[model samples]
Target: MLYIIDILGTIAFAISGALVAFDKRMDVFGIFIIAFVTAVGGGTLRDLLIGHTPVGWMNDLTYTYVIIVSTIFAIGFRSKLNYLRTSLLLFDAIGIGLYTLIGLEKGVELHLHPILCIALGTMTACFGGVIRDILCNEIPVVFRRETIYATCCILGGVMYFALGVLPLDHNIVFLASGTIIIATRLLAVRFKIALPNIYRD
Candidate 1:
């Protein structure tokens, strides 16, 4: 189940990256590069921080293949995807939700503190997009006050631990947390929800 979620998350991030690359009118190689980094950037960072050597995609080629395939799909169907208007944002939300769960699970496996686990989850969920945005010369959405991005991941991570105390199955708890993250993001976007700006208007 975790493996499936990881693959799906990779696909989502890759597609999201491809869309961004397309918007920037990048070349094929640039599209693939952006897609690859956005797919595994967060996971790579998490692995390095946790001392998981060689990172994850380096150990397994499945993630690489998934990113390649996803990038191609997004590019090939760029017109159709662009018609949706919100496809990139949708995929990004899905990626973050799935990656958050994967990170939280890894932290638990290593017996890390709950707080650290949540931090790992947030990093796993947001850093990929951060890298993508930085490379694309845009401020990352996670750092913007106009959108509730990392907050969704943090709340989801907290919910994961909160649900852990229940007698529910682990998978159920996992799905619930993921759903919370995804739904929160969609709702936030729909409602124009945002954090208060610190600077004067």
Candidate 2:
């Protein structure tokens, strides 16, 4: 189940990255490169932070394959995606939610502190987009106060640990936490919710 979720997350981020590349009028190689990094950059950073050797994609070809397929699919359906208007945001939200859990699980496996686990979750969920934006020559959304991006991941992580003491199954806990993250992001976008702008005119 975790493996499935990870794959889905990878696909989501890959598609999002491909869409961004399309918006930038990038070539096929650039599209593939952007999708690949956006799918695995966050997880790679998380693994390295925890001293997990060889990283994740190096150990599993599945992620690379999935990203390749996802990028191709996105490019094939670029017209349909452009019509959706919110496709990029939707996929990004879903990607962060799923990756948040993947990172939290990794931290837990290493018996890390809960706070550190939450930090890992946020990093795993946001760093990919950060890398993507940097490569694309745009400021990362999570760094912008225009929306509460990474905060959603942090809240989801908090909720995950909060539910840890409950009698619910671990899968249920994951679903609930991930849902919180996804829903929070969607709602924030829907309502134009954001942290106050620090730079006053």
- TM-score for each model: 0.89, 0.89
lDDT for each of the candidates? 0.87, 0.88
lDDT for position 48 in model 1: 94
Error of 2 at 27 (Å): 2.4
Residue-pair clashes per candidate: 0, 0
Deviation (Å) of 4 in candidate 2: 3.8
lDDT of 1: 0.87
Candidate 1 residue-wise lDDT, 49-73, digit = tens: 9999989888899888898888888
